[model samples]
Target: MMTFNARALVPTIAGFRDEVLASRTACTAAFAAALHDTLAAKLDRAVAALHEEAETEMRLAAGKGTEDGDFLYEIYHTCTTFEHLWMESGPISILDEIYEDVVAEGETCRVGLDYTVIPTEQLGEIGGILDRIRRETGIEFIAARV
Candidate 1:
């Protein structure tokens, strides 16, 4: 398993949180506008007894809320994406079942985490785990000064 030190994730997670916080207001406004546009289009087509299932589905997906009906789910998700790392209390095992290349020792001394090296799917999965951890503990992870 590829183990990652919690400190290694600091920069990427902090950047994600900052980005979400920065664009939250704009994202919310854009989502509302897109939803309104979709509804208008649907109404227009309804008058002619026609509908675009794909277009409606796309709009709904884009505007879908979080588990608790939060409109800015993406922002919230990004903001809490690295919560797991802070609370891990141990190194993160990327491949939990495998132990062929575990690097449990000297993990903290490593530099340049480069989170972008990880595939998008795996990163999203990690983010989901972090989100769950935050929700369960009701703790917001804040960056520490080095």
Candidate 2:
């Protein structure tokens, strides 16, 4: 019964990026370091929140005698892609792309909530939020099973 508004984190990420950009000074190295630290902290918090949510969902599914692989798969797919973008592109580019994708894709669940009930729309929002964070923060969230 946990209500996770996936889109809620997008603005947070955007705000974090804006703050870093605003604080950028003539020192390139210092700017980069500050950006990285700020973004990493935000992404870490998001990842932790998502992890807890996923764990709760998995446990709920398990109690119903069902495997949560599908849900996990969805999370893995999104997180892995986010990690890749984080590594490949710098924060801003990746964040922009992720936000665009989310806007374009609308909302769709890549994985089901209870192994059978797929909240596709909400999932898309969730993925989008995470994607933006990953892109902006360059925080590669290491999945437990990926």
Candidate 3:
């Protein structure tokens, strides 16, 4: 339930960038865990695989600034581009539904109980979310980037 005060913290570019990263991680994790069980598992696996692949590609990029260092990114991109037409043998994906949320959303959907969500007129939307955040901290935010 810990959260940084956005206006108080995200004033500089680096702060904004870091806030975006944190928000992406937080929002995405919340949104994903709320999806259908099977789809959620699929998403979890895909994100992990993509993250590992991205790290490898980034490492290759870091080895040398030249395009010749390695075609790691290109190779992965090409494989995906041709995935449906041809195939390369690879590991099978299996879903092992583990304990829920790692941080905010713990073992249940209550991870976001203390979140600072903006109110919207969308379906299933809860009211007073932003007010809740404001009242507790004595801070009013007209706009929060995240």
Candidate 4:
């Protein structure tokens, strides 16, 4: 039962062109913490909507299942959105927010996200948020399972 998680990796410079594959810390801890907090809030908001939808689905499927109850359980399980996964996975502090070095113009970060069970229905929304993080920070955000 893996859940969704996210991490940001900031790349360092080698005078351009040359890239270092180092997971070294790039930005200040304060900066990273600030981003983490802000992202968490945004994710919370997005997940709220998903939770509501899931609840609605469960309600709609209620009373339909009988002996096995598999139908009911499946409906409930399918509603597990990215936000739900994050909540179930506990605090995000355990995830990796470390900085890394890469060959790119200016500063960049890679966000590694794991344990996220993003349903197909919410991909566009979640993807938009992830993309916004990169655009806003001017950093390369990479989301992957840890």
Which candidate achieves the best lDDT against the true structure?
Answer: 2
Candidate 1 contains a number of clashing pairs equal to: 0
Candidate 4 CA-lDDT value: 0.39
In TM-score terms, candidate 3 sits at 0.28
Global lDDT of model 2? 0.42
Q: List the residue pairs that clash in candidate 3.
A: 104-111, 105-111
Q: For candidate 3, lDDT tens digit of each residue in 1-146? A: 33222223213323322333443444435542232233333334433444555555556558565676655545544544222111232211112322234545454331211223223332111113223323443223221112
Error of 4 at 57 (Å): 4.8
Compared with the true structure, what per-residue lDDT tens digits does model 2 show for residues 1-146?
23333344445655755544444442257534543454456555555554555565555445453356655644554444333444434323212122223233577433212122222243333334435545654443221110
Model 2, runs deviating above 4 Å: 1-27, 65-146
After superposition, the stretches of candidate 3 with alpha carbons farther than 4 Å from their true spots are 1-35, 70-73, 80-146
Name the runs in model 1 displaced over 4 angstroms.
28-146
**Cα-based lDDT for every prediction:** 0.35, 0.42, 0.33, 0.39
Ranking by lDDT: 2, 4, 1, 3
Between prediction 3 and prediction 4, which has the larger TM-score? Answer: 3
Model 4 — TM-score against the truth? 0.26
Candidate RMSDs in Å, in order, are 20.5, 15.5, 17.2, 17.8
lDDT of 4 by residue, 78-111 (tens): 5345434343333333134433346568866444
